[model samples]
Target: MVQKRKYAALFIGSALIVQGLTACSASNPNPNSTGTPVATGTAGDKAQTSTSGEKVTLRVMDWADSEKPFREKFIKDFEAKYPNIKIEYTLMSVDQFQNTITTAIKSGDAPDLYPIPGNMSLSMAVKGEWYQPLDPYIDDAFKNQFAEGAFVEGSTMLNGKIYSIPAMASVPSTLVFYNKQLFRDAGLDPENPPKTYTEFRQAAKKITEAGKGKAYGIIEGGKQIGRWKLAAMDWSALGGSGLNQQSPISLVTHDANYDGKEVLDVMNVFKGLKDDGSFHPKTMSISAPEARALFGEGQAGFILQGEWSIGVWKRDNPNLDFGVMAPPVPDAGQKGFLPRSSYSPWIGMSKTTKHPKEAALYLKEYFNKDYQSVLVKAGDRFSILKEVNESSSEIPQFKQYYDIAQKYSRLVPNPQIRNPELASVYGNYKDVQPGVGDILQGVVAGAIKEPNTALKQFSDIVDKSLDTAIAKAKSEGAKVDKNDFIFSNWSSDKNYSQQDYKSIQ
Candidate 1:
């Protein structure tokens, strides 16, 4: 799930206090600003303290309040290990963090370390030099410690330089969680879940029929547009086609045919369920969290969600019996594809940090196996280190999901679409008319009669957006070619490869 920004103020603990002047000034150096005193820690070496025996305090910021316990533990351990250094951890709401951090950075008062917000594209951040490249501090031995695909291009790397490390393993948002007891009560085999879309729809009908208004076959929150888009992308990929599954902007490659067939099929599935009275009555009215709550309360038989939901369900409904399943495919024997990026919630150093050496030390320790274990065991997030995950004591369900992510997931399309300049142009075309999310919501709510027409309109808007972005990029002296958008030999059956991109070029 993308980390959204929060707008409300949160009461942080006294231990994590905000130091220095609350107000900004031209001459009064904010300790959090990039202009603070620089530490002289050598690249790939341990941090050294000042000759005067002064303590070095580094300010770190993140928005995950749920992970506060783990963060506190890490801080305690880190300070114990390095007696000369101290860490002041600050937890903020997502919205406030992004807003305040951006403002602080502009005023030269950015935190020493913070997470790269999900809404902020990595390419844009790299281009703006907001993050300090970690290549200098990360030696070959350090780089080799992570799994082969842990550090991915367009996520952790830009122009062959590393700027950040992934805070957790990539978890695809396509997995489905279903109530096994609900299936059994509906006279369906709990052991044999639906594999094809036809079977899935039939199962939903049976469950709903059995409930007679007390339960729904499936549940989804239509109020959140992003949830709809995610569901559409997941189902389209299962149907062997996807419009924007690979990237924010759909690239019309030569072999990648997005004629709206796959999307239409997906939309029709929801439409069929809606018409059959299989979906929750409030599906279109609630938010994603509310939908999850309904599902946990045994109001729905199945829910399409990510691995993270496992922990949520366990915490909220301890007695609920649930099982994870791969998304339904178009055909019985066909395999479902999972679209995933390389890294998420990337942690990095601020370019203007006063203590680069101490920050590097903190980062190195952050990825340490011992520290990663705390994140895995306490936070329930998958570890980026291969060894930690392989030997994890996490629940068997999460381990199973991790295995699927490792074997079945494929990286999204080329890094070109991440270009900040191109993204700006493409974003303008997204809402030229009702977006895909709006169209899908309308279809499920019985507001849209023709899914094909709506999909075709969305496709045209995307094509025009791509064209506009290409033209603007060229005018700005960016060496972008229109042909880069075309992947001649690409196929949904297999993952996209450099060879496919090379074939078109």
Candidate 2:
């Protein structure tokens, strides 16, 4: 549900526009119930309560279509509590969000708060002065309500100052969502899903064969650049590939070996599916949402998506019986692990906003535990808070994915946590052309004949890109090195915690 966004910055040949703020503050603070969010303090750390009876409209923008239902009602309630403040919320499309936000900032028309675009890095956003530091509006008691490690330096907090708050759990990745009826029609046990690569391939083949042009083995949005790898990464990550779900660069090696055993093995499975005609006819042309719709319509036997489908399908097709499970491994045994990095920042306050207090208040109310519960029920994703997840048992399907993400999730080494200065080092690397996603898409689409050569070339490009990024960072006086990116002592089998970074040395 928390879609992976690439860091892409748009340049309009102008500096970040700035607007002068007329200093205003409110006195006193109080802790309130779930309906009424925590009150702010006069101290800069606490958000100043907006007491001016003047009417104000605060602008907000985000791509979380999954959270729209709760967010809309939350906004309406918030307006009821603060009659003078009206929220103009914009739910932007995931694909166009980055470009639109960047253009808005360039034009000095940015929303009150917006998530850092996929193509833009937090450091770059901060360095560009696109967001104002949030420490002045939020206090410790407010932050303490979040789960452990929610406010991470170099992520939510940079240089001891907070910039953004994580809105969703970071653990959920792609999973197998299969139609029970389709599995039964294929002569497969709808209760027992495939666990091994062979079994998965055979099941898909059987499903396709049984459909007789009525359906396919599995459906995917192949037209999108990242769709293929989004599902395939689960196979690679769970099959001892050390695949960093967020990026191609492995946390263990801090480099990529796309042509290595982990990736190649998974590629073979997808290739086999393609050769066997187990993919939907429109798989290569449809978008991910379209593929999900078709899957919901029983046009395919299975789909690889996030747990958000639990809530989505429940609302759209309450009678639809879909079983959820992890993706198949190379064999029955597991080889690799999934990285559960600390909470990643979700949205930040715009520097040019006129109503910082109102915007900060909205963010607080929107990301609280109350909203987190809504998140779980919506099946859009899990909450960042541990208590919210622990309290959720009624939603069994969503709970299943939560359990899966927790079982395999490990605390991987973070180069930025080890060296906060790596913020610049991180934002320096450029996206390699024909990336892992594109390469896999091309292979499955039958456009590429030599995956070996392409994978190796990609690995080489990653190495060069890492080297160039380090060199560029050094030139920029970041005080970073390639070794900072490497954690030779860290194992893929176990977690590398914050304390481990110190202990390893």
Candidate 3:
């Protein structure tokens, strides 16, 4: 008998780093200088200060406009605690952050500290030395404060060094948030939510039939091709395909399994939903915000979204009554799971910063339990600290969210999806004709009659792209092999593991 894999025991591994030296020339001299002798120390060591009495201001940059409240509080608390250090907070839009940071770094005007943008691969940033390693400041005692496995390989640790520290826990990419009143109006049981894909489909059909053309069973941002593909893969993963969370390149390159009946079933579900007219009529045309508005206004019964939606919907539609549920599974008895990447964007300092000691002190305060508590209470995001999670009664709503996260979520390893060179190559291919998103959109729009055919085309494109990337990497004398792409012992039923890739190295 084949040994069935278990979800709880999976441990994701760090990707092997092929180090190359790169240097950044300073364009701005003494960017963090206030002529102050600030205190700094390793994790367990007592912070020591110099005799200089001048104050130091640390410039911090991030695209977290919505987290203004938490940011304000953090700065206030941090400044109050450390009178010699002041934080200069700079906010940029997500679209502009990557370019802004890149330009700033190249021109030697980078902030003393900043978040690694979600769109920028961490490996690439590390390779370019965009962020200074935090290893020297972080000792075992400091690292012990975080939950076990909080320090992920690709995002924080690369080439045996700690580059960044995660500020938030891994959040589930897909969750079912349904309006309770809408379910009741549709003659469905609000308390007994969907447990499997079959029940979810039946409920959607019933809700749509009950709408009398005024409401929809589900609402999605179909006009946003990337988001649409994400939803498709999220739902597909719910059917036990496991390929949903992996990048398109990973699928074709065999870093993730692409050939499975469950994968095909996911495509069929999308087609069936379209055929059944279960989606909002404007789903294929409207943006995510518009779709969200429709759902908030009680024009849709259900919407698949992330934890962030709860606060938004509550604020925008104060009267609407809704509840959250885990994503459905392939069968009733099988446990449903939410897919989360092991690594999240972390806060890191720049190598060019002149105030390393003060900056490191600020990092320590930033992730302190007190600050984390304030952040959790403000609902900015969940904390990476284990104590904060254990003492979550301080924020009841967040505690509830944490419960769901702990119960239903599992982390997908980062290395395969986060390989910098491969990701860059895949990103370029994604813009060309017959891209993965294009194929998914075509299938959903009924243009591609056969999902298998479209998927085959997608796989072929991925194969060629992977071949070129691997060849280039090898020619550059990078230590990589085809074996890195294959995980023969992996089981879709279990959470992904580092052991899956151990043999390749």
Please give the clash total of every predicted structure, in order. Answer: 5, 10, 0
Residue 434 of candidate 3: its Cα lDDT? 53
Q: Note the Cα lDDT for every prediction shown.
A: 0.59, 0.66, 0.55
Candidate 2: tens digits of C-alpha lDDT, residues 150-229: 78776677899988776555653556889889899989999899988889889999999999999899998676554464
Candidate 3: how large is its RMSD?
Answer: 9.3
Best lDDT goes to which candidate? 2
The order of the candidates by lDDT, greatest first, is: 2, 1, 3
Can you write out model 3's per-residue Cα lDDT over 257-301, one digit (the tens) per residue?
333455566566667777788888888776555576788898887
Please give the lDDT score at residue 79 for candidate 3: 67
Which prediction has the highest TM-score against the true structure?
2
How well does candidate 3 score on lDDT at residue 312? 44
Q: What TM-score do all the candidates reach, one by one?
A: 0.74, 0.87, 0.72
Q: Encode model 1's per-residue lDDT on 1-505: one tens digit a residue.
A: 1111011000011000010000000011111211212221222234344222568889898655434444566677667666777898877644456578888888998888886653454555655668888887667767777876555554456666777676555555556778888899999998788988889999999999888898989998667554566567656765656433334333333322333577677788888898989989999997655677799899999886555455455555768888777777775445346555434426778998878777877877776666555445431466667777666435556666667555655554444433323333322222334656677889888999777877776666556655665677677676665555445554554666545544554
The local lDDT score (0 to 100) that residue 112 gets in candidate 1 is 89
Better of 2 and 3 by lDDT: 2
Candidate 2: the clashing residue pairs are 6-118, 6-119, 7-118, 7-119, 7-120, 8-119, 8-120, 45-138, 47-137, 240-336
TM-score of 2: 0.87
Q: Tell me the lDDT of model 2 at 358.
A: 82
